[model samples]
Target: MIVADKKPIEEIIDEIKRHTKILILGCNECVTVCESGGKKEVEILASALRMYFTNNQQEMLIDEHTLERQCDHEYLEEIRDRIDQYDAVLSLACGVGVQFMAEKYHATPVYPGVNTCFLGATEQRGLWTERCQACGKCILASTGGICPVSRCAKRILNGPCGGSTNGKCELSKDLDCAWQLIIDRLKALGRLDDYETVYPIKDWSTDRAGGPRKVIREDVQV
Candidate 1:
């Protein structure tokens, strides 16, 4: 899932201080699971903003709403009637959701309420770690399910860099070497022989170098 964290309250306040009427929009998807921009978080932020305005002797109209998803056109259409009433909108979704919402509601300015992190997984409660970079090219088959692209500090493709020591990355002792994990998993699967095969230089054109991407599945398209 996409992981994100809330922006500083002071920064958020500064963005909307000029706007008397604002909408605090939350997403019920990724940000919800990450505890950054969910319904609960939106309510808290709305209350805080209201309190801040009240204490400062300022008049502000703050309202909260959570969409099933901000990225989907169908979900975003739910607010089509009410969106224009606000001076501005603060979206508590990933960067994608914010941009998509802004595009959908072109008349209203959309602000990001959280900082989008990366494609990651939840390790434990309150702990999320990067898992994939979405490079467009997948190589997990030869690596025994361990992603060297995202897990490796240096993003090495073939083998462990010399910086690793005792199965730990030199960047940090607590961080496991991506190559080490790959080798161990491969050994357990009796696919150690796969390691001997040299992987050619990756063609990065399929990645971000190619710019924004989209998947078009003709089979699923209506």
Candidate 2:
């Protein structure tokens, strides 16, 4: 899922200060799973903003809403008529959702309330970790399902870098050595011999660095 974190309250306040009436829009999708931008979070932020404005003696109208997904045009269309009631929109979804809202509602200014972090998964409650860099070339089959491209501190294609110590990453003791995890997983699967095969340097050309990627499906095209 796309992971993100709320921006500093001060920064968010500064962005929408010019608008007296604002909409705090949240997403019920990815951001909800990551605990960054969801219905509950939206209310918390809205209440905090109201308190801040009240303490500052600033008169502002703040309203909150959560969509099933802000990135989907169909979901955003539902708010088309209602959006005009507000002077600005503070979107609590990921960066993609913010942009989608902006494109759909060209008249209203849409500001991001969170910093898009990464495409990741929950390592544990309160602990979200990146597992895929979306490098465009998937190699999980060769690495015992461990993604060194993202999990590794250095993103080494073939490694257990000398910096790794006792199965812990050199960059941080709190981080598990990705290569070590791969080795252990491979061992459990009786595929330790797979490690003997070296993976070539990644061909980033297939990834975003090359150009915008595209997918065309003749059957899906109407």
Candidate 3:
């Protein structure tokens, strides 16, 4: 899941300072699970904005709506008629969803309400941890399911650098040493020999430096 957090109210207020008519758009997708942007959050923010405007004696019109997904054209189409009524849109979705909305509605200014953090998973109640960096290339098959690119402090392909101490990262004692964890996991599965194998240097040019990446399958294409 993609994790994000809401921007500060002060910052959000500043973005729409000049707009009297605003639409607070929320997404019932990834942001909802992370508790950053959702229907309930949209209402709370809209109410807060109204209070702020009222306190300042400014006449403001704030409307709130949550789409099943802002990134999907079908979901975004649902707001086509109503969105034009607002002077600006504040999207409470991930960065991708915000861009999608902006592209679909070219006339209105779109503002991001949440900061996209990372591709992560919920570890427990109230805790989320990053699991992938989306490097565009995956090597988990050889690494015992541990992602060194994101988990390792240095992102070493073959490592627990010399700085690692007592199964903890040198950068922070609280951080579990990624390579140590990999070794332990592989050992538990009787695959400790995998650690001795060397991995080639990552070719970043093939990953992201070339340009935007895409995957097409004739079977899946319409």
Backbone clashes for every candidate come to: 0, 0, 0
Q: What is the lDDT of every predicted structure here?
A: 0.95, 0.93, 0.92
The TM-scores of all predictions, comma-separated, are 0.98, 0.95, 0.96
Regions of candidate 1 where Cα sits further than 4 Å from its true position: none
Task: Please give, for residues 37-110, the per-residue lDDT of candidate 2 as tens digits.
Answer: 99999999999999999999999999999999998989998888899999999999999999999998899999
Best by TM-score: 1
| Model 2: worst 10 consecutive residues (lDDT sum) | 206-215
Best by lDDT: 1
C-alpha lDDT of residue 128 in model 1: 97
- Residue 170 local lDDT, model 2: 82
TM-score of 2: 0.95
Q: Which ten residues in a row have the lowest lDDT in candidate 3?
A: 203-212
Candidate 3: tens digits of C-alpha lDDT, residues 107-166? 999999999999999888667889998888898988899999889979999998998999
The global Cα lDDT (0 to 1) of model 1 is 0.95
TM-score of 3: 0.96
